[model samples]
Target: MPDEHDQDEEPELELTSALVPFFVITNGRALPSDQQYERTALVTALKGTSAAARTLSPEAQAIVDLVAHGFLSVAEVAGHTHLPLGIVRILLAQLEESGLVLVRKPVPRAEPTDRELLGDVLAGLKSKFGA
Candidate 1:
């Protein structure tokens, strides 16, 4: 029943909501100027449900947080942490094996898993100086 144009629209419907990105409630104006606000709010929501993450060893938690964000490469972790590339990659592999971490795709796409969102926020705030 759908045309080719309709089929192309289907994928976007999966991830985007109809709600406008932002609004000035008092002024009754749509203020959806920044995509980053959506990203920030979603990250906050994900973190709300992740109390269990605190139970992880500090280093492991750090690793999880780092990889979950848009910083999706092992080399980024190494550069940020100032750890040797081999050590960082080895730890990442171990985390993956232990079900504590994963390697996300190279490009950050439209949607992210809950864990990814939480990890992104935490990664963005590893330290006051960095954030």
Candidate 2:
């Protein structure tokens, strides 16, 4: 039987090995030239659907699998993959270039005017504390 120390060390080793590919993909690489993929942009995999994904590098394949369930923001992808934001952006740009992933820009939310916000706040206060 494996000793307790051996069992504990196995998972750590596995994790380090898993991160190796990401390091290889990103190391010594410049940020992708395209600046369109904002951190909040949503990314979805076209994996089986996009013929290009068949030739993806291991790092890109890992990202495709993560997005297989649903779309995720670029920042979320970086966080989940344990890659730096710049590296994730570079990977995403490459995948997008090959049509393996769809990057949707985040919708810009309109800020409410101060007058409109104050009106709503006043209504809420009146409802709770009486006019």
Q: Using Cα atoms with residue i matched to residue i, what is each candidate's TM-score against the true structure? A: 0.36, 0.59
Clashes of each: 0, 0
Question: Can you tell me which runs of candidate 1 are displaced by over 4 Å?
Answer: 1-52, 104-131
Writing each residue's lDDT as its tens digit, candidate 2 over 1-131 gives 45566765446444535535645786555687545778899999875754656666767788988898799999999899888888888888877877778899899779767997899999999999997
Off-target runs (Cα >4 Å) in candidate 2 are: 1-23, 27-29, 33-35, 47-51, 111-131
* lDDT for 42 (candidate 1): 20
What shift in Å separates residue 127 of candidate 2 from its native position after superposition?
A: 31
